[model samples]
Target: MPEAVAVDPVCVAGVDGCKAGWVAVFRWVGSNRASEVQIFPHFADLLASEHEPRKIAVDMPIGLPQRIGSNGRGPEKAVRPLLGMRQSTVFSIPARAAIYCEDYREACSAALAHSTPPKKVSKQAFHIFPKIREIDQLMTPELETRVYEVHPEVAFWRLNGQEPIAIPKKVKGSSYPAGLDARRDLLVQFGFVANFLDQKPPKGAARDDLMDAAVNAVIAERLLNGDAEPFPTDFGRDERGLRMAIWA
Candidate 1:
């Protein structure tokens, strides 16, 4: 008999901070099923949770090239000469890759097609790239230290927004996809993902959990494919070690 290789377990988490609730789906790598569904009070809870993630894939921005709009000082100013005349989010390395990638484009397009208000859906999806950069720029070192240290809250806020952080109730439940049908389209992509994991295409409709799992799965795919890297510094080596990457 030949020896069998063991599949390493990878835990995947998907975070969606909706208008009235935040939903998270955690899945183990070896199986096609999610290990848990965590509905938290707010986005902070998702970040502060005691659970340790071996390989995290957050659907958020990780970094932004600093000095884009700095006071035309220091290294930022010098880099401009090297970067040429044009600099925008769309042209940034990460954004360019994310927007053009076949899977992400298809997934985003599918989301728009299903949405009732395609414009709004398209706007939000389109914002992810620049927002990642924006958040990284807007978040202060002091605030970052107080909350996440170097945890990449910038990316989190870019995807979920700071509103959820301020107004916890806005994103706290089951009826997350109530009136916004277009936004629901984003959820639909997740549904397709869950079905794919289950080895069955979506029959007719899928649950929000399935959709969340799908998003997590996409993040997982990106991390393995080297779309992102882990943050350099550790927040602290505690019972809950620092998250290496926002999307890893």
Candidate 2:
């Protein structure tokens, strides 16, 4: 007699930060199809709404550092080799003291004082400080265990058979995104419909935001199944006690 295949329902989400708010993708475990995808202005709103998932995988750095130098955090260091050409996507997080600075000068000063080698905050890293600070404050230890930090590139790399995609995310000649169709195609192989990519992103939500969030949601399912793994296995905690690790 043939063995029976088991089916069970699982609910999880992936979230990405965007201009106006955040984009999220929600789906059931072991299925390619998404239950829903939407954008929310605040993480709190997302949590309060009916779309809440049992676990949320987000494309943001959760556990922050008290200090750093030329090298980034353990999880960030761990992903670059696996990502190859796309490794530049992993921006190092600034010191915890840098998150509250009012301006670039203040941030630079804070970084130098707080970091081990007296580092300065990168313009790019500083750009996301608002989001990082927001999540840092919102995530109390009690509420944070359910939220996992994930990198979309790492998730997609795993989806693409552990090989990094050669193409850049944006168009060669223009800033508009390319390879979205191809990404959506790869996602379809996982069980989502091609039309899943057709959902018009909210104003200020870039196309990549939707794709990034969707990939996060997919990885959340992987985490539930125990298929996902954390980087650097050796994780540390911030002053507030939020763990610093990334899952893929």
Candidate 3:
């Protein structure tokens, strides 16, 4: 008899930023089960971890532009109308120069200077600047071949047969149970087991964060199977030649 051999499971990840850090859900290839759930304080650390997922679908903006056009970084503009009411979840990312600024006011100033007819950074967009900057700093054309920019609402829109979710996952900054259940039901239809969907979120992550990450994992599986499509079919590139397109 041959000695037992260890085999590493082929996997992909869906990541969402949380209050504590990044919450990543690892799903095995060719299956719906999530093999692991983790929270990493830094994006780089997740990359360097042992899992080495074949693809990473993250709910963060990538491919920052040097100059902005009327509709934001192209991907956001392309996907917004598809999302209907859920479109608000996609924030308009400003120029790379603006994202590097240490202060919110400075970032707004940079955005105004770099955008056409001038635009100011929204407080909501400003809040996620840190996570955006984190991925931007590490992204390269080579790395981007595996890491993809994804928006949970956009993913959900795709999951829900191209229809925008009828409910908002959050209302007035509080999680809505009905909305969460609505999404969970959709995930179930798409092959996720109820046990995984109902599991308590790891520390530092909210229930919504975990769900968002889980949906991203679904997109990751799509990407791996070559079943996913990018918004703005033509896509865009940042100064460093990183591709900018939201995948679903």
Candidate 4:
């Protein structure tokens, strides 16, 4: 790889899994392009190898939003409602909404009965209250903090171009209309810009593909709309520093 470029406030992605494991970094090029500039195997590696990112907009929920209870006990509860749980954001995506409900439900069930893939305890109970109580009871602040989660659906939109929601016929009620092609374009755009920031592309050039565009969206949001939270210059001491930069 060539010498790393000078992109500030790089956009990053971190995943936890066997094959599906990677952290992507991005930066903006000129006015028309954003790219997935860099790829790392893990967050630790990224932190150690690359510069400190300005604002890492993850693909997972940072907070579960303290739940509210009818009684007066501070906030109701801070639990991720079963999968398919819905949140009313200005830019809501049906597919994402449905997944929240489904994912939380599945995650909740797994927590209950000790191990996941719950036994055939009771079909009716599973449908009704089922595993929610257990899930609600289990979610703690520490666990939430330790875990890295962001709604890919939201990231997809922010990175792709912040398209409007228009559910598809098949996934009409709880699905997104944006297809693979559009998503790919967005990713590629992000990758190019990210590479530009890093000043060098990856070996295979596969990892940076989506991140480049994602990072661009992040920077675009910052410069155009001032959406992201700003980090101080001191935040850049250890790492490469945030990917924030002035392209246009």
lDDT of 1 at 38: 61
By summed lDDT, the worst window of 10 consecutive residues in model 2 runs over 170-179
TM-score against native, each model: 0.34, 0.90, 0.94, 0.37
State the TM-score for model 4.
0.37
**1 against 2, candidate with superior lDDT:** 2
Looking at model 1, the pairs that clash are 19-170, 20-170, 20-172, 21-171, 21-172, 21-173, 61-155, 115-182, 190-211
Ranking by lDDT: 3, 2, 1, 4
Local distance difference test scores for all models: 0.37, 0.81, 0.90, 0.32
Alpha-carbon shift of residue 36 in model 2 (angstroms):
1.8
lDDT of 4 by residue, 1-248 (tens): 89988554433333211122333544432334343345554444544545344334343222221221231111111111211232222111111112234444553443333322322223322332322322223334443322223333344444545442232211333323244334444555544432343343355333233433344345433443345322211211101211211121
- Model 2 spans > 4 angstroms off: 1-8, 30-34, 171-177
Which tens-of-lDDT digit does each residue in 1-248 have in candidate 2? 99998886667989999988778888877555546877788888877768557789998898777787667677889888999988987987778789888698899999888877777888878888888888888897887757999998898998999987766677643334456776777888877777877678778788788888888887888888888888878887778888888898
Tens-place lDDT digits, model 3, residues 1-248? 99998665678999999998999988888554556789999999989879888899999988888999887798999999998778888888899999998799999999999999799999999999999989988999999768999999999999998998989999999999999999999998876777777889999999899899999999998998899999999997888998889999
TM-score of 2: 0.90
Looking at model 3, the pairs that clash are none
> Candidate 4 — which residues are off by over 4 angstroms?
1-20, 28-37, 64-150, 156-178, 185-225, 229-248
Q: Tally clashes: model 3.
A: 0
RMSD of each: 16.1, 3.2, 2.7, 12.8
lDDT of 4: 0.32
